[model samples]
Target chain A: MEINGKKYKAVVIGGSAGSFSVVSKILSKMSPDFPLPVIVCMHRLKHVRSGLVEGLNLKSKIKVVEPCDKDKIEGNKVYLAPSNYHLFIEFDNTFSLSTESVHNHSRPAIDYTFSSAAYTYRDKVLGIILTGANKDGANGLKDIHDKNGTTIVQDPASCDIDTMTKAALNLFEPDYILTPEKIAEYLNQLAS
Target chain B: MARFISKTVPTLSSFERGLGLGLKDVRELSAFMSDVLGIPYDHMPVSFFKRRLTNVFAKNNIRNVEHFKELLTSGDIKENIYHDFSVSITEMFRDPGFWRYLRSLLQNLSPGKTFTVWFPDASSGEEVFSFLILIAELNMLDRIKVICQHPSSRITEDIRKGILRNKNAEVNANNYIRIEGNGNFKDYYSLQDNIFVLNTYLLQNVETVTGHFLNTAINEPAGLIMFRNKMIYYDKEVSEKGIKTLTGKLSPGGLIAIGGKEKMPESTMSSFKCINEKERVFKKHGFDISWNNGN
Candidate 1:
């Protein structure tokens, strides 16, 4: 969407156990010129520091970093939430860090980011739930669908850890359910 | 206005620089004096405060105005500064006729199906709860949705978290029940000791959303948009833009409301058909209007 002479597209991704490989597979297929701010949240122990930033950086073509409070969302940036806090998008399209507890036992919860982005961005939002071990991103993907935004989930059979993806696919009819390569291809097409 | 001739003169820039005062401090002081005295500090500057400063400098035998900078840096003069600068502008329900007309308008609109009203500038939460009271009194609370601006999300983190403290809950609820009708507005909050935290269910039902009107349009077209007494600080250009945005966001048959003293400027006034000129309500023309950027 064009807002105030600037174009915007928001992609939000959430995953668990097999997120690193899925992220790498997707990013490897994306073209160099792909534009859009992508926010990713991966469920890990609240106390244990996540290697998500480092892990994803090795796999992605785009710049990846952990987002700080009020950091403006910019095209081509990949922002990951910290392990313990629920990340939300402020009305201004900037990331806000909240310790407002958890949903479904995940601190950097997928639902929080997905719901907040969907609410803030409206129809321009895209939500993706990938390989995980729990039903964390199911309600979130559904929330995105409810808001007239796009929702995507990795194919359950193709997912290494199928519980999260299987749960999401069964509960909500996501707009697209595909393998990692296909999901990557679709992302590249949109980003281009 | 007579220009002051200092006994021991210094150039304006030198005087300011010597005093170690930044432009922001001076601007704040100007605003404070203007607000307290109900005068335009820039156009019709206050001479008395300037003269007082001059006298203070002269009495101290300070060669340059900079020498008295200790006052601002230290405590003695800060208290005096605040004492003279505080503003007490608004009175309770300052405009009686507006309230009366609004009450009557609510009674008239009572027969409609789901008459939603939006108050976009609810600074102290009074207007949102006030509308809630009116709608609840009409037994139409279930039918109506009052979309209020979420105050916390816009500003800093501390300000966001610290807003709407528990102390005002009792009074706010009492005002709602007493003014409109008796129903426990208190039930909408959880009181632990003196801390009354608002129940999310009440907030959710009332439908408050965090949004920036400058950057985003209202999610759903509103039946009525009321932004009153909030834009007085804005100049004509800004005011016209606000009016245009509100008009564009209103539903086809919906109404637009503003403060009694506020007006749609001539440049963009044609977009609206005045419903009640004195009451500051207008009907949207429902024509294609440009979202032309407003500075």
Candidate 2:
């Protein structure tokens, strides 16, 4: 598989339910000096803010930190959307957090981040839909694909809960379908 | 090897018909809102403007964009539309780190010197109450004065009466615990008929006024001025003008706090020094004569 020699500006990953471990595995294998900024949007308990970032940071070579509203985007860092805030990628490539009512029964809805990134970055974005129990990210991944951005989905068979990946597959054919290990390897190749 | 698929992806249009309005209809509605309602809908983000218009349409049972425009121009629905235009999402100690930073800044002030803090857009009294709680906790309530201004007279009246929304009690308590590290959250407010009424004693040094921050002139300088989150709603020009006006209200060596998500306009950046960049805290530069004179 090849990326068609296209350099991407940013990578957005969306997940829920069983995605944390997969995300940890992928981050653990990433180079500390990865060039593109990575944004992770996942479902979590709104009232709890401490554990997710810490857990991901423990194994990841690159710095993984929860970003505050208006934090500037920088290379080589992984930003986890804070719990209970809908994170949007601004036109200036910075983040804006909104406390507006929840969508898809989630505050930090996957669709909000994916759509905002697609709108701002357009074809420069690489969107990945990982394991989850719902169809929240399906339309967003489709939006990325429609905007000429690269789209990847974890193979349904490999996902602990295949509902999310299947939803994406049902909506539109993605550019790549791979297991978690292969996805990490593909990302590392891009870094190289 | 990761499986790569080569499929002819049919182009999908992600654009949804906004409120079922044609471009001409949207333009007409925008004009009505600006000319008749004085909202300047053209400056609002398209998505937000559409959402609000759709909400008003649904709530008022207007048939279409034309009807909506007709109702807006009639002057009878102006108040209803205006009521829905305001965004009021206030939280107690919205950002704990910001409050902590403010605490540190306040600590450096000269002991026993009285200072005034201004909240130009005190929406629902959550932030004003939070500051009062912080001052009370610091045992400096007598040394600090608060002036809260809002556009709505009803909200100002409620704020003056020390009434807060009961729904925020849990989050308020959690934030208080995080800030103070220990406390019975109920100590700050008494519950009456499911609403939390702040203790009137905490309101001793606070005054509530009813007026738009932009129209109201501050005759005296404020040690600290907070106009957070409200800037995001304003258009670029309005926000720039607001920053200038707020900067003019700051005392020499005073500080301005904005929403963490907001950025200081580039034109005004030279006038203030960024103290805590991430927290969006800026300080106006000037010599403090009292400190310089060793008071």
**Which candidate ranks first by lDDT, i.e. highest?**
2
Model 2's CAPRI class is: acceptable
TM-score of chain A of each: 0.91, 0.97
TM-score of chain B of each: 0.54, 0.81
Clash number for every model?
Answer: 2, 0
Sum up the clashes in candidate 2.
0
Which tens-of-lDDT digit does each residue in B82-181 have in candidate 2?
A: 5455555546887777787777767666788788899887777788888888888778899888998876666777788888763767677877776763
**Tens digit of lDDT per residue, candidate 2, span A66-171?**
8765568988999998876777776656776766556687878898788778876779899999999998888888888878999999988889999888888877
What is the DockQ (computed on Cα atoms) for candidate 1?
0.01
Scored by lDDT, model 1 comes in at 0.59
Q: Which pairs of residues clash in candidate 1, taking residues 3 or more apart in a chain or in different chains? A: A36-A76, B18-B66
lDDT string, candidate 1, A1-192, tens digits: 443333447889999988878887787777756778888888876433447678778867898888754457888888888755667775556665544335686777887677667656767778888999888877766667667788788877788889997776666567787888887777776754
**Residue B268 accuracy (lDDT) in model 2:** 90
Cα miss at B108, model 1 (Å)?
74
What RMSD does each model have against the real structure?
27.2, 5.5
